[model samples]
Target: MKKVFLIICCAAALFSCRKLDQPNTREFTEEAYWRDAQDALDALTSCYENMSSDFYYFGNEALSDNAYVAGTGFSSVSLVAGGSYDPSNARVTAEWSYRYGAIRKCNIVLENIDKVPSMDETLKRRIIAEARFIRAYSYFELTDWFGDVPFFTTQISVDESKTISRTAQNTVLDFVLQELSEIRGDLPTNVQYAEKDRGRITRGAAIALSAKVQLKRGVWEEVKNECELLINSTENGTYSLLGTYANLFKVANEFNSEVILDLQYGGGRTFSTQRSFLPQTVALLRSVLVPTQDLVDDYIMLNGKAIREAGSGYNENDPYTNRDPRFEATILHHGSTITDFEGQVQTILTQPGSVPATNSVDDQGASPTGYYFQKHYDPTAPNYNSGLNLPIIRYADVLLMYAEAMNELNNLDADIWNKTVRATRVRAKFTDAGATEFPTGASQPQLREIVRRERRAELAFEGVRAFDIRRWKIADVVLNKPVRGIKVSSGAFNKDPNGYIIVEARRFEDPKHYLWPVPTFERDQNQNLGQNPDWQ
Candidate 1:
């Protein structure tokens, strides 16, 4: 079913990538060009156009739950191995190509900015800052995923490209941090240039992204300080935590108060078909992406404790109740009656025989996992369409970053970590009134575990966990172990589908699955390149 949706989305809403073959296209003479504000805006908007790529969102499916680990016929199935990654894979190609495509746009923007003579100096600086932020962002993604990726600044000629060696991760990170820091003062907090200009980079977005980069590299002081600046500042009305967890992903909540940066979509021009994954249509998308039972069990109960914790009783039946409300709201489970943004209850049938009551319902068409994603989907919004903007960074992310940074720095006060976690439950009316006292006496290991668990529970299915596990040095314990998935209690794989609760077994992914190998084409093209340690 998910494959169908991918086909439909790819056909109708394909991403627009920047062309890299030509250094300059449709150029103007020195005497006539650089004399107008619109030209600058047009060029800037052109750079922003890269966000439309499915590459940034759905296309990076292997990074998240979109695909499952099966036999060798599929791409990226080896990510489940959890160890070393061969950089020669096609996934590396996709990452490298798309990033270089973005870098090319940055080169164009940086070189052309000086020519926009008529634009306001401040406005031009902001535009330049925006371009720098994007360039830095692309490089950051590249380095984090494939460490020691080839870093290019100015446009490269065909002959010169072959000689470029991969930059060391530290060197690339230093450059990105430097670039982001230098542009901090020049950018505006938010750009208010009417409708078309709404989604462009603002100061808040830049700092938020910089904070994220810092967090990934384990830069404790910088991460904490940057997050502090953003959370405390109200200069541009650019940051705030939304009242409800649901509101953060609602189709109606585009560019809401909590959003720092989002890949904005609209009615006709640039749009995404992500809404097609809702439980209402999960029957058709039988197995696109299913949440793991591990994730389902991770959400803490309303009492701010894990269900399996001592004294919690860990009731399997009626599990939806008493658990964190965000779990049910985010993942459409059995008996969940989700009303679309327009106030219409969706038909998300869960039982084997319960489906086929509506338009394409039947055992043959039901979700293979009997679950659906309810967030950011609008059933009433035409053909499973919702003008939902996909968030790239949000206030909650910054809060979590701060918590993790402080915890890692070993100077964390209990108040700081607890405040961040409580903020997530604020909309649910959760209070610490009767809960266990904050773990002020806990050791560093204990506190780190708490932060890690908090991130898993809060940011589940946000496409960050698999990579997060890699960075935290716990993938050996977490990923190598096979998790219990729902199955028939009678030991039949195909019979009585709903009778399954679960039992566990050992699941081992290779240790070499951590770093992806540099692509074969890239290595072939540049003799100076070498594959990651174990891959060659």
Candidate 2:
């Protein structure tokens, strides 16, 4: 978010060496490059390089009540979620710059792709559509977090970059939706791609991302229409909830049928986050972000009843048992066992006074919340090698988005619920009919809460919770409460009367917290880049 005058061209090494084992490297410039298809491909490939690190992806969960990151003084998430950060917060700045950096890469490709000599017309159109998809996605993220922001589709001069003012979010939204609509036809369908061409942008990705953007905007009809196109309109390509809930996040199942769009990582690319999430007892890894009990409690019983419900069969002493099947795949609590890369199953004890306590609950540099996240832990990524692909958009999310839209429109009947919620639950391997069946005669309000809760449970810790709460306008209700941890009999942490540990007291100011403050560093460089309200 600085004056980041576009140099426009840098070493091809600045791009990813290999796009998931494909050798792609070439330099591009508006003046010198753009000789052939390879040049356009190389420039476009750079746009895909900014998928971000695993820490940033998972650390975003800390922005909600679902997770907690210990105060690191410089950790932007802890500072912002803790409600003490200002305009200079690094995440604010980094999030802005990184996306704009991506948009810039895409702009280069779109503006110059036509210049390539003798490239296949269809391939060139696909490449253009791919570039536009990335640009649209970046802008969606920017406006999602920043509200209104500087908008551009072409590379700008340093001075132009400095003086351009923030555009209205409505205008940016229109542009994003328009871009996706225009590009969807030009992109290939997911099934149309060859085996080696997997992970590239496709018509399905565009529609999925468009539905998400529409959902955020509360355009229920548009969301339903777009999701229906992907779900029922076979022309877009086939997508379904595939494999078990646990294997969904495993390294071995990176690009399964459930995935619509994913960030590719492999071939010397490092996809490492387990070291910061696992306790030190797990091969000396340490927890920087830990799961809050709030997240754990969101998992309903296997009988489809909440823990506090009349017949959930939930035991406070044995809380992890008889819960949602997804709970075991997602959370690692005290007494949970993890198999090492060497095939050793080690039980991690997070109790207050566990032995060999270096990585136990409440140990220094350990999980402050006494819980760990087990999802997306890549045992195959030994030495942090490329071992996982992060799903940006998946089929489950599409179903949930469609359900939310239908519910909001008062059209969430048994048929829609069966297609979306039931399909998603069945894919997650829910056994009990009560857990998977529709609640007949439910009012719109009840249906709303059910859909929201279903979204939270199904998509937790996948970098979607923060956006969901924000779009639902419930951040004030959720983020303002203290993040609670597990049931602690006695510990350094403050506990409620029921003995659940209070991890941290959180704060969220409505309207102000809804949109983060524009980074002060950006304002410093470009005076036209003014601060958001309540931040000045």
Candidate 3:
């Protein structure tokens, strides 16, 4: 069965006006829809469907250094990278409206769930908890992207919504934390869900989300506390890392032990993660989102050192050899083998004048960086209709967050390393014990950098890098320089004289660019919604 409800409540019934206060007048009005238990369930399901759209799942990566957009069109990625977008960009406008639209659905459900007569009290509480979880999620996304935004928990009239001013980001975050905390006990644990309800929010998920909210705010102690709650609840089977790193992303292994929260896509509904990342050699559609050389270099060598470090066994002439195991699992470089649509294995040839001619580096719509993403590719999917669920939160992420927060709150210790960072590396299949073990006597500053690099390598292309950079306050430093791609020319693959070719120059103006400007249209509609500092 599809995890999401196929029949979504009509938008007119949930959000006819921009303001959520007005009663839904569409086919399923508040009175007509809330009359029965099934009606409440359907409305609740619609909120989930609206909250986990594809844009947030995949498109947000382009806002960071993980991937580059193909064209110079007015796309959100291009505009944001160039520091040229304003409130009116189509993608920005869509994101604002989409999040609010989902919030409206949640509000409708929360406002009317109590009216369903004969509904089991336990069932009603679960539905209310789920709605609040989604509402908190929507608000988190809104505040993270746009900074201060119009905040309203209860449905407000159109006039009131128009006149409402932006709430401070800290205030919104406080509400998000409180909401998640209150709903934790009301939701089921990961082990309590039936097979059919695998993707619903759970107690562990609420805790994980709370940790993430604190992580974004740089509250290291709070983040550590929240992560420990879930990590220490192992007896309840709340969460654990899957046996292998690669298996965590397979379509057949979705909702596995490691997945805390994921957007459900199967049965008939699906996503295009593979289509967007697979090379044209294997996929019917051309690849658009290509990885950059900067990300590729971040992966450490198998010998427990960075490729650039001395005695790391890194061959500059043959660069892909002796690299991190994750490099092969996450990236499709030259000479990587892929099973084609015909169930035949084909080697990808990214170099010029190679036999079995594959797409050359820098080919139009091909991988501009000579690297395609293999992380979420599902070979069994028919054409571009892949059923692989996008993981919103995973056990590995919790471990990483715990490791980072612990390092910040207290210096890195052997026990913490074994539980979090070392455990993550073991799951990644690192055979050399040195590569997976924590270095003794490592200073806090050195360990901090190590943890940050681990996060970039482990979670690349998962739409987390953007937030990671922003939360770390390093976007201005890392994003201002030019993004580089691999050297592409005739004959043997030779490095460019300057090392790497500049693909795109990115700019992140401090203060204003850290937060997106409030949509010009939204500001125009609501005069009280002021723009971010230095933006107008």
Highest lDDT against the true fold, candidate = 2
- Per-residue accuracy of model 1 over 288-309 as CA lDDT, tens digit each: 3445456677777766677778
- Which residues of candidate 2, in runs, are more than 4 Å off? 1-32
Q: Compared with the true structure, what per-residue lDDT tens digits does model 2 show for residues 398-448?
A: 999999999899999989999998887887778898788998887999889
The C-alpha local distance difference test score for the whole of candidate 3 amounts to: 0.78
lDDT of every predicted structure (CA atoms): 0.61, 0.81, 0.78
lDDT of 3 by residue, 53-118 (tens): 555666677777777766643246677866777878877777777778777789878877878888
Error of 1 at 22 (Å): 24
Q: To one decimal, what is the Cα RMSD in angstroms of model 2 from the true structure?
A: 2.1
Clashing pairs in 2: none
TM-score of each: 0.83, 0.95, 0.92
